[model samples]
Target chain A: MSPLLLILIFIVSTVVGYMIIKNVPSLLHTPLMSGMNALSGITVLGALTATAFALGTGSKILGYIAIVLAMINVAGGFTVTSKMLKMFKHKEVDNK
Target chain B: MSDILFYLLCGLLSVLVLVGISMMSKVEKAVKGNFLSTIAMAGAILLTLVYYDIISVTSLWIFMAIGLILGVIWGFKIKMIEMPQVVALLNGFGGIASALAATVIMIEPEQQNQDQLMFILVTASLALVVGVVTFTGSMIAAGKLQKVISQKPVIWKNHQWITGISLVLSILSIVMVAIDTKFLPISIIIGWVMGGFFGVAFTIRVGGADMPITISLLNSLSGVAGSIAGMASNNPLTVAIGGIVGASGLLLTQIMCRSMNRHLLDILLGKTTSTGHSKGVAVEASTVVTASDSEEDIVSDLASIIKSAKRVIIVPGYGMALAQAQHLVSQLSDSLEQNGALLDFAIHPVAGRMPGHMNVLLAEANISYEKLREMDDINPEFPNCDLAIVIGANDVINPAANTAEGTPIYGMPVLDVDKAKHIVICNFDLKPGYAGVDNPLYKMRNVTMKLGDAKDTVKELIDMLR
Candidate 1:
């Protein structure tokens, strides 16, 4: 694909993604966020793959940076999400 | 030109992926939501790289699929009960990812040009401050929620200076870390610790009544941090939408605080935490009056109550939050509707756990949002109402704010239910509301306190009307 085509693809995807999220009603935000926070954990893999690839191809600088960030994004996201779920702690919820 | 486009693509994908995951799990098992978002994010990143000729598709697939499976399992295990911790985790990761990105660029010797280096450095720094604060502060919040750390006020004698000095030091460290590495990391670490310290101090000191606002405040902070991540990545859409969440959440928290007459400084300083020992107390399961005569008891009293009444209003509070009695309240409203009586909801801004909490609860039971009235909107109507049924509500209905001269919740907005001709409070007890103050609304001459478990009480009242 041409460079312009790739950039266009990126832009279109981003817009499509943004519209999907932006349209949700305000009431759904917390639950949405709660769900997203858990999912954000996967961004670690993205960061890692991007970084590792960036590194593996001799772009050592961007590569290392990506790895460090990816790890933090992955690990940190999960930890925060685990903690978020604690606030709703109740006995009834537990039996579930 | 390509770098900018790449950054923009990455940014959009990040938000889109997160949003995609959010929708997939609405209120289903929360873990499922997190798993979906995580997998989507991981996939988006891999796809972006392959599109850019940065990475082969094979490795990206292998790595993320493993990640996808692990993340999904983890997401499923995390109960909704752990949501606050999850929020803290998100804030921490946003901060940490950026900080690490900055660290990578700073230590990089392979800089072909200064522009990329500068981009990385600034973004990393942004990440460091936000990440550290979020990471540490969220830990403190989690600790408080988990009871690992005391949630009681940590008011030192010199709290203002302590909070102030830490904040100033944090600002100073930003410049210091950028200029030299010797103390920057330590400073950043300290700043992170200070953020948590202050957050806990701020949160623990605030009364339990203000927990919803505290949750909202932290939520806003998390949103701001996410926007910063977007900016560091040169993503405008992330910054824009994140800013919306951050700003709106804070506004909601502020409105909730104001309606309660709570001062911002007081909440931060932990002033009210110790003073309101009466908060969170379960009201005794007793009533000043009971209707055992069933239909005859309600029917006999209904005619007189409805006959002399000019209007009738219903007050819903935390008890309603616990009982989930909104539909029942609507039923009661329908019964009164037959008597040619007017019925309205007396909604105090801070009536329940979260702002608009009662309204939200009622909306779930399919109550019309328009039928719910705000304190300012419906206070004038209380005087004309022949009956004000106080259902599981306390502080907002208390007349002491207007008549008792001095109450902790003085000047806070409330329904003038005391002004009505007949007041019936269906509460478990008169112990106090979350504020720990005696409600003179109970003592009104026309007030007849009907006590029982809220659900059963309302059900009995409904049976009588039938």
Candidate 2:
């Protein structure tokens, strides 16, 4: 991808993301933040590509660690967010 | 995959992620929204493997599986009160991942045209700096939140000067990498060392009460790091999703800053809660007045007030989380409702250690989401309510924010608890709160101050109602 195209994609995504996130109420801000935190782990894509193309053993090992860390970020963040969201129950539900 | 087809798939996945985020605005659809986002992420991962022709990599799967297992366990084990630290730690993981990926790219640059090589190298260097900083800064923030490190702001001698020099050096190293390929290895070392030092220096001076803003800003930086890593590797999917996350974090940071009536730059420069006021005199004076009124008499008076009141608003702060009093608080609210009082919880945006953190704690105690109200929505109703019950909360309800000029909390919006006909304060002490400004509300005749552990005090209220 060209540098200009990459910059355009980032700008467009950021603007659209901001507009969409503005509608979420303060009530769900914690879950909203944690969920976005998980999305930041999308860097796993870069890590995977780097690991695949690595020429040296040291660089490959670094890429492997990156992949693991990013995956943990993705999995841990989404799981915790779901757990929190589950607790936000309405009054009419069966009470704990 | 052809370039055209690959880019089209990236666009499609980005829209799916956006739609998922939009669904998060409503409570009912939020769980499904999170699931949709997870699916989009899975799709992105699969797309990357196939497009890059790395589908048969056995070790990658092994590493990812290990991470998944650990993440699931940690996510399940974490209590709601510990959510702030957990989020901070996970953000650090994301940051370091980007930094490592950027490092790998820097070590062995892909053979490309001269123009493309320069762009990639520069973007990779930038990514490494941002990622390392976010990683170290978030670890410090997490340590502070968990009380593993001192929560007090640490001001080293000439702290600002050291922070400035480190920042400049990190930037210079990035510039060196851009100028010549030969300087790559040495510049990378300086970038890592200086970036890490800068993160610690910048974060250590921020006090505990200011953690919400700091954590939110670091969250934004982590996302920006990931997006920049995407730029280094030329991955559109990573760039787009990372950009969205970055924007979301920035929005949350803006909300937290506005709610606290603070400037982001002030926080970055370490101008935290301490305003250098002489708070000892004010605390000593208030303790004497409270001593004259016996604890039993105050409890009985508060019980009667609670029974008689028709409308009540409860204000909860970080102290409530610290005392683990959410359950007792929920019980008290139930008892008040049994006496035929209409109840609502007034939650400040910056309450607890993070944005909306108080709500999660309350939710964990089985308090229905319907009963919680934001500051703006519930502020007007305080005057009409017959009683205001403040549980371990101080600065959010402090009337000093309105009348005390030159204080840190001056002009900051607070709940109008003073407007209620009667008030009950259950806090840890008579001292001023995190803002270090005396609360004039404690001295009002209509207000009864009960200084003790909130769990015991709130349980006493519940027992009196029984």
Candidate 3:
């Protein structure tokens, strides 16, 4: 990939992100942070590719560690945010 | 043809992710959309790897299985109280992932033939520094928020110099790696290790009071690191998601800083001193004194106040969560409503250690969202409120923010409970809040201090009202 194209992708996504995020309410900040953390977990793609093509033991080990860490972010981020949003769902009031 | 299809899929999935994030705050059943987008992201990653022939089907499946099991277990095991720290740790994990990926990619010998090798190396170096710093800094943040370590700012007079020097050293090592200079391996190690040290140094000086800003900022840093890592790997899928996360986290950090009325630089440099120390001294200098009322007297007095009051507002804080009193507080509100008094809840943005924390607890007790009012919306109603009951909340309801100067939280916005005809403050002790400043609201003439465990006191109040 050309450096120019990658920079273009980076710049465009950033502008798009700013527009979307500015609408989120203060009440959802924690969930929003966690959700973004999950998205950052996309490093798992690079980590997986790195491990599969690793030329040496050092690269292989680092790749494996990276995969594990990224998975934790991916899985934990989505799960936590989901649990939190569930609390926001209305519940029937028990007058007891 | 297959390669084209794979790239197309990745592009489509990236769009889905953007759409999911935008819908998350707007729609009901957002979790479902989030999961669908996550699946699409995972699919894009897998297909891209296959197109590159980096991993065969069997190996990819094995890695996916392992990753899934670990993720599910970690997610389910986290309790409600641990959510904030767990989120912090997740952010740290993302940072470590990017740093590790950048390191592995940098050590490869194939970069010599790449036309954009210089740009890739620079991006990799950026990832290495940012990722290392975020990883270590977030771990420290989680520790402080969870009380695994001291919640106070651990600062020395030379703290700024120490952080500045370490950061410089880290940058120099990264420069060596980026420029293909001598001692490559040693420089890489030094760069990341010093970056890690800088992370710890940057976080330790921030007390718990400013943790929301710290956590959000670290989240943003991890996103920036991930984006750089994406560029280093020449993967657009990672780049897109990383860019979105980076931008969103940055915006959220800005919003948090604006609400706190502090600059991003001031927070990072540890320049904003919260009168945490001076407030302790002010405790002695404070001339106004009042006798702490006993529980029995408080119950009797509160009962009469409730009887006469037509409108009441409740402001709950961390202490309420600590005592697990949301259920009782809910019942008390119901009792007030039954007595023909209109009851409302005022929720502070930073209340209960995280944003919307109080809301979750109250929602658990089946408190309607309609009855919950934000600080700005509820402030105007205080003037007409017959009684304002502050349960286990200190700093948010502290009158000092408005009336006192030179205090750490002096300019910060607070709930104007002072404007009410009567105020009842319930707390376990007279200690100042996380900011460690004296609360002048306790000394006000219309205020009554009811000291006890928040749950038991609220239950006692319920009994008295009955």
Task: Using DockQ, rank the candidates from best to worst.
Answer: 2, 3, 1
- Compose the digit string of candidate 1's lDDT tens values, residues B1-466: 3766655665665565555444433333444555555554555555455554656646544544554454445545554334444455554554444444333333432431344434434444544455455555556656665567765555667777776776666566556555655654565455456654554444555444665566556555655554544444443434443454455446555676777778766776666722644443334322323423464654567547755555888888878766767678878777777767777787787765444455545655555545677677788877677888889988877766665444567777777887887887888766776666777566555666666788888887777665
Q: Is candidate 2 or candidate 3 better by lDDT?
A: 2
Error of 1 at B369 (Å): 4.0
Residues B78-126 of candidate 2 have per-residue lDDT tens digits of: 8999989988998899999999999999999753335688888888888
Candidate 1: residue B370 Cα off by (Å) = 4.4
Candidate 3 chain B has its poorest 10 consecutive residues by lDDT at B281-290
Chain A TM-scores of each predicted structure, in the order given, are: 0.47, 0.96, 0.91
Instruction: Summarize candidate 3's per-residue lDDT along B142-161 as a digit string, tens digits.
Output: 99988998988888778989
Output the lDDT of residue B210, model 2.
86
Clash counts per candidate, in order, are 29, 0, 0
Task: Tell me how far the alpha carbon of residue B314 in candidate 2 is from the true structure, in angstroms, after superposition.
Answer: 0.8
Q: What lDDT is reached at residue B89 by model 2? A: 93
